[model samples]
Target chain A: METYFSAELTDFKTLYNVLKAITFKEYATLRPMEEGLKVTIEEMKCVETSAYIPVQMFESYYVRPQEDVKFKLSLKILTETLFIYGDDGNLSLKMTYKGPGFPLCLIIKHNDENITVDCQIYTMDVDESTDFLCLADECTLNKVVVNANQFLDILTDLDNTSDDLDLFLSPNPPYFRISTTSTMGESQTDISKNSEMVLLFQCENEFQAKYSFNYIKQILKVMNFANKVSISTGETGLLGLQLLINEDAKQMYVEYYITSMFEDDR
Target chain B: MRFRALLVDNAAMKDLLSTVNSLSKLSKDCVMRIVSRKVYFIIPDEDTGPRKPLAWCELPVNFYFKEFNLDGVSQEYNEIYLCFATAMLAKSLSTVKQNAKSLKIKLTNKQTPCLTLEIELASNEGLQNRQLVHDIPVEIIARKNWNDFAEPQFNDFHVSIEMPHLKPIKNIVERMKNMSHSLIVSANNFGRLSLQIKTNMVNLSAHFTNLGIQSFAVGQDNESTVGDGSANESIVTATIDIKKFLMFLTGMQLNHCRTTCSIVHGKMVKLASEQVGALSLQCFFTELSN
Candidate 1:
């Protein structure tokens, strides 16, 4: 028999810290390809989040190029198993999978002791992932990059009772504005082009769309772990958010796709 | 049935209140027994339905109080046992924890027998002295019910070891609690401890070595009988409910004190801690049969 796959990492927590941000779903599908491993989670067909950790991010990476390895496992068990190392900076990890019927094995070594974990997760047949069309010619509306910390602060100040979040983008002054209305009052936050937090802004035309605040709040889960975030809206009311994990050469990305709630639906 | 105590040290009183508050996290009602110079808090586990764990805590009366006097029911029965609501006492103590100058505890005979905490607050500018009194009702237990709250003694322990820093162990236990309902804790005589949890999805274990082994005088007599056998290398393991074990670790308030753990193979586990002022806390966990 051939060796299925095996990979090693020097700083095991880097992968753990990113996967923890998307644990709102119990089961996540893991797809190992030539480029990297994509961990995907979908909720109620309305929102989908994925964290991509490239092969270069691992110290030692190996995989059978011809074979396709895709499996679904419990995210809670995976996260808890990785956290057993207890935030030690000098730990090493080795993960392996044998074949279709074998279990996923993780070996963590710290100091002189080693912990071996065997997870017998039942794998289900892979399902086609929902495709959120991002064609440049058909659906590009607005794109902006903002500091993750500043964006989190603005979202925290918004009234939580409000159900809808209105995003206004224009080429004129006050390039970006986020407003919400509830029975209590209406709160609006305006960000000009000159603000230090707004690193890049591009808009083809004036656009306004209302999205469910509950769906947008999912982005806040990863705000503390990310340094910068890019937000974009398309003509079909599809929202895209990309979070940059670290600024160094070995960076990872966590992306979210959210479907907006239109005015006529209310 | 007369008792009164005066606590003059603000820091020590705060520590006492905090320890009581932590104990309240485990159970809502407990029996507090006071003799001439010592006090003990005991909770007996119930045998039916869900497992109600037991706890025993002891502290020297002079450790936190400046002046203390007590007269029990009689000479033979020198101890007084009172059943009180731990939550009510914790709530009352928390209100005066920050700025109280002195605290006086007295047994009062109101409409109901009550333990009254009279707190004297510090005087502020252009304001007079402030005083706050909170009465917590209690029922004095008769001497017949005192046998249910006796000190626990463990005679047949396979291994007695001083645990490593509790912060790391606590972290591991907290994570294991999320995966399974019970946890398996095993330790050997060679200063190694391991925690394991097994479920259908995963089997996880963490090992800590190079720990300090506490040599107790009781274990010395059994040392020669097992001469060169596997008793020296065998591992003593106990499986316990994760939530109950977690509560015991967090409620002891042993952040700065030394903790020693003893395991009775397939039977029970006992943990003890002693501070500088003759204050000691002990917790026991019974094994759950597989």
Candidate 2:
């Protein structure tokens, strides 16, 4: 049990805010690998989300030889603890995990105040990851890429009482349509193929799927930090939403898989 | 009893108002004791359940106000004690803090005993002088209960050290409050202060060193001095309620005054600061036995 891991990051604000946006759950599983760290959060085994932070994001990254180095931690606590360094100024962060059953330690150095914070956060047993049907291959029936900010605007216009969201995709007329129905009446937002927001529209056949409005709204949390978002649907009604958080040298990705509700189920 | 004062300086009035506003966050009501030329606001220890620490604030009557007058209970005892809702007074002061040229505070006996504040605002556009009056009702505590508000004394402290920059401490303590209910503060006479929180899940500690140690006053014995060849080099430690400590930190965020924190091992923690000729704020936190 003599394993040691340490990593350093220069600008913590970007990484801190990105992790905070997806902290809707209490516990998240953190898997530290040689390449980087992978954090996965799930809700009721129905909606699973993961963020892949590659090694290039850290100023200095290292991992000793270890097998199955995964632990469960409270996302809420981790996010709150990181923000204590504040948003302004250049904050340098050094994180370490001594070994198995040892708490994860974070040392934050604030440049302006010449202050350092050493925080030890407890870790729990890692839960098995939820395996969702793969929709990355030819099984992806429909895929569309849109500007994240524009999609957020469309989501904000939705009626508060709407329960179901219907997404339509086509290769020709009315390239994309997102409509919601509730007692307040029906609201629909349509985007044409020639619109600037629609970056890519690839539809093998005209496909449509129905997903819970509340589940789809979760994407709004990450919309501000993401530049572009890609939405795709599988033949088995699995919706994949990928957000491009940063386009700099250290690219980050936050992806969500929401199990869609079929038309007949409603 | 008759009490009246006039404040002419806007900056002094604003500072006094903001300090009172911060004090109001600690408790809803407090006793304002007025002596001949000094004013004291005291919040005694609440004995209803667990120990609630006391707060004592003193201000010179002539510092912020230009004209002052006072009529106490009697000539021999030249002091007046009145219990007033701090929130109400702070609200009235905040409303007229900006435009008021002069503020007059008086004790009035109307439908109810009230502390009347008359704010005279600068005229806008050839209009008549504008005045706004707010009557904040208060309860005059009888002389029998006056003995309860005496200043607390904790003479024997293990370590007394000046605090570091408040901005960083405030940021860390605010987060600690969210994680745990009690905070453990430990300091050594060698200029090292540690803020820690421990629970079944996690134990977190922040160590700050190279702080200035305030010299003990003359004739005061200095025991528990670090690096003095003492057998036990244990740090002076006390666990205090995190909420109260955070409130003190929040109040310090607004003022430029320096703060000194003194801790009695496993006994109590006292925080004291004063602005020359203006006001002083002191808070006491009784240690919680583990």
Candidate 3:
């Protein structure tokens, strides 16, 4: 079988965990480039998430580049297939996509048992636009960097029923604040720019934006494993988050872009 | 009925507390039967209790209590049976594992039938000890209904094998539980055990070998309670609810215990703990709901 794109990973957990976090949707588009593999999943066409896996992350990565090898597969089934051995023994994964119409073949080898499991996940043509909303690239107005775990702890108290989550970034007192009001009552969290948890703070202008609480809640699924989060906003009230996911000292990036809701929507 | 027990030994107190804590996960309520020699925690298995099979545990009264006294309805049946919520009992003994200098458990009639647990706390100041009391209401079972709380019976099992320490399999089963509701667990007399789960999407199985196998000769009275495998090299398997199986592994609190997993071939699966001087816990999971 001629392989268009193939990558060997010594451990499956690295890829499995990253995919599991972004698995809000059934299918996600995967693009294999010279640099690495990019997996993107979009919701409602307004909110999008992309995970960048560099070539260095793989034990061996090969690509023939048959006119930009790209396909979409079920993220739910793919993540489940990665850990088929069920948390026991050492597992190595060999993933291959053979040109077009061929299923993404995953060969998982149980290192301890000397057994191998072969899975063929049917790939489909990408129907959604592969474009990722990079908020930090242009129309940027504010930025705030904080430890993801700490931020996640603060966000846990947010009432999910709250329709909108307000974000305010300023150079004044309580430089970064997140406030929400719902049936459970109003709750607000304030963090100063000088706080030790804030790694980097850049706010050229006082900016305020509101996002759907449901969309903001999606980050919590993956934020626990992320080391740090870079929060950025555009002039048009677009919010962007670049999460630095550290596992076994290896760094991976997952970017999330959320379109701010109109203030009158609430 | 009158019953009071004083537990002063810290090690025994912790053991008793651990047993109760483990039993708390098996059922909402359990029968606490008190005798002169032993204190039995019984959740009698009934046909109605199919989803969650009953658990039976025996803790020697001499090991836990410094003073053990009980008066039943008659001298012939010198035992008291009390039905209480396991969570409440576990909550009352939760502190006993930590700073319990002494624990006195007595049946009290202060406006209600309750088992008042009075625990003497060890103070860091080295001054007078502080005290904590918890009143947990219990239903005193009548003597005529005592048959309902009898010890569970494991009649016929096909293969019995000694299972490895559950701490290692805890995460493995937890993850497999997500894949399927029923996990087929099988073992043979040749020291081989396997856990397999079959679903519409995937068929996955893990095999563990070179383990000790229980001999059927050990089953003198209760044929399958101590585990029995009369056949050799023949695999006997039973399908068990994956969640309940995980519970059995997680609820084991006693340390350095040998667990025997016996399967009755599509009928039932039993996990019985064996530790000399330590309380024995037998967990039963009926076959095939999924």
Candidate 4:
């Protein structure tokens, strides 16, 4: 299922950054999808949502045969600003969210382009929507879900606590472990004795989907509302995001339960 | 017995002295050492027993305040309301994974055996600490919105009666109704009383067993000298205690009546023999008529 939404490009950049860091491999087809440098997207933060694509993105730059068409929405990102080229070159779209505890829209530079745009943005509450899409242009390689404490160990190894770190992290740990190993042969001439590689998993699934801690953490770095973020993988091999809504309300603060579904590909 | 008689004059002071003597001599008794204490007669009246004829003299009083601080902030005051410097030691120790601090509450008047009014004050950046937290009755009353709140209406019946054979029927119906808003049946010498109270309503009745109480001839049998001193009166004419009337009529134990009265006649008299009994009966009918 898919949904579509219209949101400024800037708001989606950080979200795009987060989504990109978790994807192992992805291919974008210009024929199936429109080729556009600048597009607006709205994503679902919750289960219930209304989705639409921004007219400014789909109408001009993206060469598509269809008009007034909508698609399934995936996620919504709230960022400060996004810039793209119009017929006039160098156009900017601003993103903003309105809430009591939400962060204000921030202006970020795409590149060294001395271009800025002024625009108003209104962030909708996260709800399920069928007509929206949240995508990252880049892709990810290896993803391993580890306990927050264990992940802390991993981050300590990286020691890359730079301001420009594009990593995301969540407190969720995977329930299973998967590893691939290959056996070496003693004699090359023995054709009958063939060597094989085996992959063992703590939990088996028909689809294979994993997430990097850095990616999840970055998307929720400033989120004080939810406690856990759920990670799910789809058949397309893309990581699906679902935030666990906490039911235990006795707590003074809000918390989210995040679960990531390992793909079953058996 | 002699001490009991002395206690009749100064019970609280006697209790204080007994406590001081019970403690070890080595331990300093701060209460006993307090050279000054102040006593105030907020209201002076001769009816309370004896007349002072003058104001109470101010005496020297000494007290001490102890503070327990964890961070030099959130200071807790202990034994501040005491009129003596109590010699009690309170110690607390804890081990934390990381260095942390917390305040502990301890009472210092272990030997004084006095109840203290404790107050906690804090600066408020939020609503919780906005108001001062104190155990003082006046402070507590100040915190409540008694002015805007409505007081619950009470259903009451006042009764009075003067009969020799029947026991005094206090407005027990009204008292019982006040205690529990419901109908009740009571039996005694003069008559049987039925009381029913519903929310803001009340119903009461008295049915005499023999030709009713008013028809029964009541006359002085030249009983005794302790009568009301009226020659023509039969039943002793003693003032009825309205409070006691409610007590007895409500089926509350007769011994529980706080008010006292002189016995001029027989204990066989019904509750209707008292002034409050008659008055409460009148009130019951008046209320029913209204």
Cα lDDT tens digits, model 1, A1-266, are 76566788777566787788788888887777778877888888767788878888887777788987877778888888788646755677777867666666777766433333333444454565545333333335788999999988999889999998998888996789999999989999999877999889998688788888988887787777888888887887777788888846788888887777757855
**lDDT for residue A219 in candidate 1, whole number 0-100:** 72
Alpha-carbon TM-score of each model against the true structure = 0.76, 0.90, 0.68, 0.17
On TM-score, the stronger of 1 and 4 is: 1
| Docking verdict class for candidate 1 | acceptable
lDDT of 3 by residue, B160-276 (tens): 788875765666577678767998887765677878777654455666677887654333332333234765245677888888788778888678788888878778889889787
Q: What are the Cα lDDT values of the candidates?
A: 0.77, 0.80, 0.80, 0.25
Segments in model 4 whose C-alpha atoms lie over 4 Å from true places: A1-130, A133-175, A178-203, A206-217, A220-226, A245-266, B1-290
TM-score of candidate 4 relative to the true fold: 0.17
Comparison by DockQ, 3 against 4, better one? 3
Q: How many Å off is the CA of A97 in candidate 3?
A: 8.0
Model 3 residue A51 lDDT score: 89
Writing each residue's lDDT as its tens digit, candidate 1 over B42-160 gives 76565425433377878799788888888898977777899898888888888566678999988889999999999898887866789889999999998876777777677777778
Q: Which model is ahead, 2 or 4, in terms of lDDT?
A: 2
Query: Interface RMSD computed for candidate 2 is what?
Result: 1.6
Ranking of all candidate structures by their DockQ, best first: 2, 1, 3, 4
Q: Rank the candidates by lDDT, best first.
A: 3, 2, 1, 4
The regions of model 3 sitting more than 4 angstroms off are A1-17, A29-37, A61-251, A255-266, B44-53, B98-101, B108-111, B116-126, B129-135, B188-192, B200-207, B215-235
DockQ for model 2 equals: 0.52
Which candidate number has the best TM-score? 2
